[model samples]
Target: MSDVLVIGAGPAGLHAASRALDAGAEVTVLDAHDLVGGQFWRHLPDDRAAADEAQLHHGWKSFQQLRVRLEEHPRCRVLTGTEVWAIEPEEHGAAARVHALSGPSGALRREEVLLTPERLVLATGAHDRVLPFPGWDLPGVFSAGAAQALAKAERVAVGERVLVAGAGPFLLATAASLIATGATVVGVHEAAGPSALCRGWLSRPWELASSARKLTELAAYVTGHLRHRIPYVAGSAVIAAEGNGRVESVRVTRLDRDWRPVARTERDIAVDAVAVSHGFTPRLELAIAAGCAITADRFVAVDARQATTVPGVYAAGELTGIGGMALSAVEGAIAGLEAAGGVIPRQLLAERARQRAFAIRLERAHGIRPGWTDWLCDDTTICRCEDVPFGALSLTEGATQSLRAAKLSTRAGLGSCQGRTCGRTVEEILRQSPGLLGTTTTDQRPIAAPVRLGEFARE
Candidate 1:
């Protein structure tokens, strides 16, 4: 059996490992979390397992089946609480050398492991992309991802009165989860308006059939919103959050086609908490370290077979693109089968194509618009880690020309996060500036994930 290392145990990784093992390969699935499921299937731990875990998630049963099968498979090794910190490229057709630490991250003792697998699969997934506004750094303002996660995994309400604001179908689900957690949802808001939605979801009606497979889930969220009498507002956003120290209320403003705020259309809404998300940003550090080709749009570049530019390396899931779970799983299956030397079935190819179209629709429907910057005042916090404001970036001021120079001068992305949270936003702020963009990109990090100095010394 050939050694196959899958660098995540999310939906994509699990499917990939299962398919690879079925094709007669030895698979080792490494996940950073304590459990196999990534964020999508995240739930309470076994000790505090939810009595109705299935209620919080959409595909709990299927996830359980695949997860159980992999854990018990003779040719599989599922390593939970293991994080790959770096990938060193090999010169002679060898898979990248993976450097990792395994154990409870907070615990004092953690074991380091180095593996040289013949094949590698990366499904590191994505993080929530929040376009910053004034007072976004406040305590009660939460990213849409964090809000849903708290409600789903911990059964914790973000606030007694919560307002869900963001683009994409995800806002509906977030509102549903908030309501489930006993939060009084003031409303559900979408940044994209009816026109964008029509262009994205209705323009190519035939292609939507591929995505319609999950329409039931969408319908359920919509039904819940209606049943609860939650107003669904479109073409609007929370322009500014306000409070003394934490968020108390937000200024909601109508936006134009380019996402520019419409004058005199702003209104203040009182809410204890604000849950917001514009879209998602792909996690590409592992792929970048593995020397895979990234697209102009910053996603990992993959072909019809899910092969990366680097030999013996494959990519799937959100890193490849912002397609949903079903798309990621299909890509994973294809990558695993091909990596294991199994011929991919024709139906998988068709499904992948359908999913790709759906991703395009998603991009059109709810993707971030350039005019989102209009939401930012000069005093708006750009990098929460560094507490740097928009005016400090000076993208249009022509003071510091390069991204690196600006980051250094203002200490924007050089903070504790190492740019994971604000790097893309800083880049976007630069992109809009035109003259501020430099050869340096915030995407590349020498260390994919955080490591202790001791861990680095061990390596």
Candidate 2:
């Protein structure tokens, strides 16, 4: 049994494993991908030159340093291409057991490994929060994160001409990356107004001033947008995507301060593909299954020491909230030290508080306004997995409703994705529907990811 088991190899997991090893704990790091760095510092193919790869990823040096240390440390082990399906906490005085299937890409008959660790740190990270719009189910419509992944990992562009739309600083980064990969970015439609940006800057002036590198990066991305002639339109959103089979054009709509579309402000922009994302939602399947307490805002709740309500279970990174890389690293270090029975320094605690405040402000500024549902038409597909349309979700008056009941009636969120893609949208619909007793939450399942029957039999 390992002393500590980190469930992800992202920034949070990497930092946690390193700190735990420093405290004389045996650590095992498992990840679904074949590389150490998560999406942020995705590893380039071996054919790419070291210098070229370094140039593409900003956190190359930090990732390299952590990777080297982890590799050299005798007490640490890193396992890639491993999918954890379930985590079962043991009874009193027994270590928790983690069930996973391990294999190379496209390989069958994966070996099953059961990991027993005294402590578990969850840093499963997050996924793109997609809002439904017409033609979103088109072939060429991809999430902004998916587009960036294609460009970074495979050096492939989503299309010759792309229109990126969303509300957040992430849109800027996505646009910059697409342009770097020889794609013609027609425009970027940001739903939030300029006041959001101004508020973020003014409120977090000290945070911005403290990070010189971040300021430089902001300048660089702004310069790229100017050079590429990509129009970064504020107070606008992609109201609809239009095409026969694939994305060919998008209808952009101007929005008011409350994010309601203004009349006669719709315009058509021709593009081969559309990459849209509102923000990120934490991947809380594993955390929820472990019985961790979540915050009112739906993030996993943790104390300053990064310890969850459950003993011997800690969470960091986006699992706790949608903090950026720096905050994730700090939280991971604190969790790692505490999990390994080490003292958290006072200075570290202060830094975590400061960074967390900035994260909260950022989240508030980019919070999705409820009025975005106006973009959805009665015929728009809300749950693409089950082919459920918006018109099918009609709720009866004065009837107590729940998401599960709606799923039973309309067959929504019952498909392969298991509600990861449309769960948030469905929840919102339920909230707005009249006669609902209260807000509905996602149903928990034993297995976080799908597993083949043969693999289960092997286990």
lDDT of 1 by residue, 362-423 (tens): 99989888898987888888989889989888643553577887787888899888888899
Tens digits of per-residue lDDT for model 2 on 1-459?
339989898899999999998888899899988887887777675566346666556677888899889978989989888988898777664346789888875467877878878888999998889899988999999999988888888778899999998877778878887887889999988888788767766674777665555567667789989988888898899989888878888999998877888999999988999888899989898888877888898888998789988788999999998867778888989988888888788987877777677677666667688888888888899889998887777643222277767878887888988888998888887788776665557646578877888777777
The global Cα lDDT (0 to 1) of model 1 is 0.87
Please report the candidate that would top lDDT against the real structure: 1
Residue 1 displacement in candidate 1 (angstroms): 2.1
| Sliding window of 10 residues with minimal summed lDDT for model 2 | 394-403
The backbone clash count of each candidate, in order, is: 0, 0
The TM-score of predicted model 1 comes to 0.97
285 in model 2: Cα distance from truth in Å?
Answer: 0.7
C-alpha lDDT of residue 201 in model 1: 82
Residue pairs with colliding backbones in model 2 are none
